[model samples]
Target chain A: MTEAIQNVANPQIEVKDLNLWYGDKQALKNVSIQIPKNSVTAFIGPSGCGKSTFIRCLNRMNDLIKSCRIEGEVSIEGKDIYGPGVDVVDLRKQVGMVFQKPNPFPMSIYDNIAYGPRIHGVNKKDLEGVVEHALRSAALWDEISDRIRSPAFSLSGGQQQRLCIARTMAVKPEIILFDEPCSALDPISTAKIEELIMNLKKDYTIVIVTHNMQQAARISDHTAFFLMGELIEFGKTRQIFENPGEKSTEDYITGRFG
Target chain B: MGLNAKTSERIAFAFLTLAALTVAGFVLFILYYIVSNGYNAISIEFLTEMPRKMMTEGGIYPAIVGTIYLIIGSMLVALPMGILAAIYLTEYAGQNRTTWAIEMAINNLAGTPSVVFGLFGLAMFVKYLGFGPSLLSASLTLGLLIIPVIIRSSEEALLAVPPEYREASLALGISKWQTIRHVVLPASIPGIVTGSILSIGRVAGETAPILLTGAAYFLPRLPDSVYSQFMALPYHLFVLATAGTNIAQTRPLQYGTALVLLMIVLAVNFVAVLVRRYYRQKLKI
Candidate 1:
């Protein structure tokens, strides 16, 4: 436990020998990686490569699926989250997640940001400040501060996605997981979210699953390449993209075969 | 163009128009018939006063009050149980054989005859529980009759609430119960309320169930409590239409009661339509 704590002091997440299956189909296999603290780490892969599945495992979102079975050690802040008696809710609180599609709750923008804090018992009096701070962190407050009471659906798709990011930030989670956050947005919106993600790493650890290699190269400090549910390569983003050591990595990044 | 093809296309178009007009004409005919017969019987006094001197001398106040009581009473009994059962079916229960069986049972319950439900109510509430022939027994019978309807509608409403809402709430680390309370219920409220209003309409027009379990013949007063004996519109209308005293002189009274009963049923259905429209408008925004 003490050694685990030492490892976590410098890393936000540590997964060891992780494997996952959905009924008879294995989605991940013997994957191990360290996500460093206060940095952006991007997972780049083709669709169905288990990038999203691995991140969902970080917050225990896979537990919601009936046939899903996970085997491995996933620890956050040196505590093994998969250990017995560990509260999945607590784990999720510390590790917030944003999904592929922008899903703002059917509510006002202010309420969307306040939802997380309120659930975790943030005081009503302090809620406004939290909401404002989160919106500002997500780079959305300047655009939406005047219409915080408007329904979130009123926002453009890009703005709604940012509001979702703001909602995750409002909970003050230590780690934020983005599952293809930019996949559904326009180029301008994608660029905006990418910029916001880069800035967010100054204060929070971010793990993003993205298919855009240029995005991983531009914003991420480290990148992990996954294929067929296996972690093919992991290293500095510049090293992986500019001069990949593995032939498969070279072929994929060079647009040979996704 | 081939003559046969062209002629057949024209025939098809003509038949389609005829079918549309036929439906419209049928609806208009029914409305005209009801209005032609019912217009003269409707009066302010007919609506506001109770049946007097064996329904020959007064209005349908007792019947109106009784219908209201029946609807309110049935809704009070059915709403909680229906919503809870819907929640269990949609959110908690897995899609297993048992859950499928329960769903089939609920669907079958919805299709059961109203008279059969009346018999069940008589056996269960009036006879076994010894509630006597009173408002309570009548309400319980009607509630049972409508519970399946409410459950089916509520389940559909709950299911219609986008799964994304549940995921958003759960992803925020909200407990499942809290997610249901804060997100699922609020979104489903309009649907549930609309379904309940529809169930109220069913209870308002139901005559067979009340006949089996409620008080018989004329009652001079409104039900003062849940357990009090009461008069209802459907039973009163049925009795006046078929077996009222002073048949020649009391024909107008019988017509008035029938018109009043029709109005009550229409009013309940109209309110339900309004509620559904209101929810749809809110959902659009």
Candidate 2:
């Protein structure tokens, strides 16, 4: 396993020997990686290779599954996220997530963006400004700014994904995780999300788990390839895609196998 | 293959349609019989007057008020408790042995007979608690009888809200309780309200619990306190049909009382339907 992390000073997220299980069925093996600040890192692998599970470990989403258990150290910004006296709510606020499917609340578009802020105790007077800023940041402001009060379901799938991104940004989180966010979207929507993600790197660190290898090649600055719960190789996206680092990484990315 | 499949499909459709119409026909026939026999006896005087001439010729004013009170009291006891218990079970309870046991217990409570509830109410609320066969005792009994229904329906509603919503909310750093109050509970309103309305109908019509707990054969006037004895429509109809001085003479009056009871239940249901629709539109789900 080539886990040599290159060209990084002060990594935003660092993991060490992370192992996870679902009722004794090991889902993630000893995996470690260091993700730099202000960069897009993509995790690509075959189905059930634990790429999605690895992404969820960042925000501790696996806590919701009753049978899921973990034994490893995951740190964000030099703080152990899986440490004692930590609140999942507070950690999630700092590290937000966008799911595979766009899940807008059963409320208005404006309300969807404002949900995070309101729950975080943002003043009623400042909510409009916060919602607009988040929407503008997500690049969805120009399209549906006129109908902010309409139900979120009215938006197209791609637009809903942008709305979700906007929803994540509303709380001003420093890190955002996209878990196959474009899987449910069409290519056009996927392209738009890709563009939005590249532009977002200037302000926030992004970790995306995508099945599409071409998508990883197109958007990510750092690429990590996994095969069945173990990290195969981790390095610059260009080197991983173009040059041969590991035989499986070469096989997995060249359309030989997923 | 096509013709045989089509024939079977048509037969199934017809069978389902016939079953539905048969049920509807039974209901319509009951409504028609009640109206035809009771309409002649209904008058302003009959609705307002107290019984006269050995309970043979008068109105059921107190019974009407008593049923309404019972309905309100039972809701007061059941709605908040049922909804909160349901929220606790679905949102807070871990998937473990305790939750499994509670789930089994709730299912059993739902299948228990209403008369058993009446008997339990008699012993617990009436004798042990010293509430003494009053409206309080009956209201508590009916509330307990229908609480399982509310909890089950509420659990369904809560579960119907996709796990994604809860995840989305939690992902935004919202606490569990806040996620439930803001997202989960609001989305499940229609299901919760519909379930509660069905329970309300059962409470309004049930006679057994009230019979052992609160209902009287005839009240001089409306019972002023929850502790006082009351006259309920189902129990009133029961007395008129079996224990009245002239059961044959008051046959029309029995139907009238039945008609009145049906109308009250329907009227309550109508209001609940409007509320459910209003929430549906407002939430736009």
Candidate 3:
């Protein structure tokens, strides 16, 4: 009876009244959501609906964009990430991100995965084991183990995407954000990424912004439907898909509107 | 007769080919003229031995060494500063008034005449700093003159590196400087090295900047130190062709010196091309 609004008993990430603006245009308006630990939460909306913008806020990736100003609170593990003392680099160490486009470093396959660990001062001796484990987790080790020394560009597009995923996993972040990761991927590749993401939630809290409603339904434990910049419904995926409370949410899920 | 597309295209192609060939033709003509006149002076002693008599003997070796020294010295100062400035502009500086002003200043500085830089060097390094008319003063002045180009070429190289690389590194929790060191700079190395080396050609051939700051055209020995006066190819050629008592007698020496200077510049540029290719292969870009 006295629970907080849209509350999770223990949220790994808690964002409160988060607002964002690019110059004069407000991109995110009063977005408040609590993402539970070790679970998959999918952000679904039409193009430019602020889902991507909101996910970028998790790792402070939006900081790279000039004129992007943020306000309110984004707390991870009870610590406010936007606070004055917080270093963006340290914050990103705990929150990894995968881009829509596959961007492997212009390096060998092993170096791509080893890059993060090497920078974070992981021992050189442990690096081989770490790379193997990360690649195995991303479901890519079996296909390309023979060419570990090959340039990352030698891989197929889907394999490259997985390599990027492995690269992110190498850092061992607490949370992973996927921004339309499958949008550029073919169906088979998308399925593979979906399965990998589903498996990853056991160790990492996963947040994904997706245009495909079925993808959100297929993999996510919880779903947040966004219309324009506002969160319309936040609930279990089954409820949101089968019977959404908000009209806009119902319309979006049923293909009546976006 | 009215021209059709095909006929007009042929005429245009002819004009374009002529234009390109004309430029190449002039370069070849100059090369032929210099090499023909200077080939007689080409001997081991001419290249390696010291100059003798009243400006008409031995070798231009001291001048050659002095030019190399100036090239090395200027690059020592310019390379780090140019690369750092480029990194700051591309990575850190916001699109504020400060960055705008800095960019404008760099561009305007590039267009400022070399003689003006020479004069400034005379005032600042030679006179104010009391370095005197020496190799140190000339090197510093030439460094200032070439920095704008280095900054611009480096900025272009930095811009050519895919932004996706920067974002990828940063999202992996790497710091800005670490990302630059590991990814951006390494990727842009070929471009930076090529541009920097090619600019050395310009540094070798500059006359006025050294004229005010340091070049002596008659130093018997190698510059004893940075503060000592030195002779350079352009100034030696200047003294051979225009100054001194034996201008007509040293005409052959002028052609020889000019040929040597051109060859030095060409040799440096050839090394630049080789280095660029090697890096491109290693980076697999």
Residue A1, model 1: lDDT of 17
Fraction of true contacts kept, per model?
0.52, 0.84, 0.84
Interface RMSD of 3: 0.8
Q: Is candidate 2 or candidate 3 better by lDDT?
A: 2
User: Any runs in candidate 2 off by more than 4 Å, and if so which?
Assistant: A1-3, B1-17
Q: Report the C-alpha displacement of residue A93, candidate 3, in angstroms.
A: 0.5
Compose the digit string of candidate 3's lDDT tens values, residues A1-258: 013337775689999999999998999999888999999999999888899999999999998888899999999999999998999998999999999999998899999999999999999999999999999999999999999999999898889999999999999999999998998889999999999999999999999999999999999998998878887778888888987778888888889877
Q: What is the lDDT of candidate 3?
A: 0.91
The candidates, ranked best first by DockQ, are: 3, 2, 1
Best by DockQ: 3
After superposition, candidate 1 runs with Cα above 4 Å error: A1-9, B1-24, B246-251, B273-285
* Estimated TM-score for each candidate: 0.93, 0.95, 0.93
Error of 1 at A181 (Å): 0.6
Candidate 1 clashing pairs? Answer: none
Candidate 3 residue runs with Cα over 4 Å from true position: A1-5, B1-15
Ten contiguous residues minimizing lDDT sum, candidate 1 chain A: A1-10
RMSD of each: 3.3, 2.3, 2.5
